[model samples]
Target: MSATLRSIAMGDGTAPVDMLAALFEARGWPCSADSAEEISGEIQGSWATYQVRCVWRAEDRVLQLLCLPDIRIAKEKRAPATELLALINEQMWLGHFDIWSDGGMLLYRHGAMLGDDGLLTLSQAQALVEAAIEECDRFYPAFQFVLWSDKSAREALDSALIDAAGEA
Candidate 1:
């Protein structure tokens, strides 16, 4: 399955987490609730699975939105960063222009960064995240988001919980 990356803006009254899930569900995409205690959620659909994780910096009031396909099929489909960069340079998708990967994670940008173009601001990042999630729902009809807790150990425990949930 193919997935896109983008950002979103958090609004008043609605926390970022709640607003995102509600938006997806409104679009006919099934979404798990905030899962506030944990920072992630696994959204399941008939054909695909999506994992959305919100890494928040409470002291800075910032959040890093991450969404990826649970299945790593696209790893083979992915071109090298140089080739991906060329595609971005040629095709331009509104806010998305930069695409690269670090370790196991793929990263993209929407605005300008430092002196480089396509760096996303905090608000832009949030919007991009929301947009990416929406796009995934549209293109990959059957997708789910797997949520995780903040602490690494907690995330591991949550995974175990999910495994146990499935066994039951």
Candidate 2:
């Protein structure tokens, strides 16, 4: 067995994986446990689809929840994407945005460390999903600005987060 699998086996007493799967199901998410260490599903948002995944870290009792935008960043867009992600991540309390080096896949990621019992409460799990989606919705337009409109990273981010009307 792989090291990841072995650690999970060590955590069998708390059943962290089972808890994660059940949490997703309870929230009406289409979750897949095809991978013993991860549960993933698509969350339908009014604006776009957020692909959400939860990967369990057994020994540490941490569950990493990731939300990825359906859009792919182009080669020329990677630098701007990285800058925008950095700007967005700075303001986040729960998670941060990341771009994959290989495919330039944009993601918003966070983790919850379960207590000694190593299980998530229904409310806690729901909060994770809610927070991820909320952050994704808030920051996605900035990405679009950089990807489609050729806006500079700062310009895109400014347009996304700034409330011009609030300036007196």
| C-alpha RMSD for every candidate | 15.2, 7.6
* TM-score (all chains, Cα) for each model: 0.38, 0.81
TM-score of candidate 2 to 2 decimals: 0.81
Residues 79-157, candidate 1: write the lDDT tens digits.
3333433533354454332323443343223321221221234354346565555544432311112221222322332
Q: Can you write out model 2's per-residue Cα lDDT over 125-150, one digit (the tens) per residue? A: 66888899998888888988999999
lDDT for position 139 in model 2: 86
Question: Which candidate wins on TM-score?
Answer: 2
Q: Each model's number of backbone clashes?
A: 31, 0
Q: For each candidate, what is the lDDT?
A: 0.40, 0.78
Q: After TM-score superposition, what is the CA distance of residue 134 in candidate 2 from its true location, in Å?
A: 0.5
Quote the RMSD, in angstroms, for model 1: 15.2
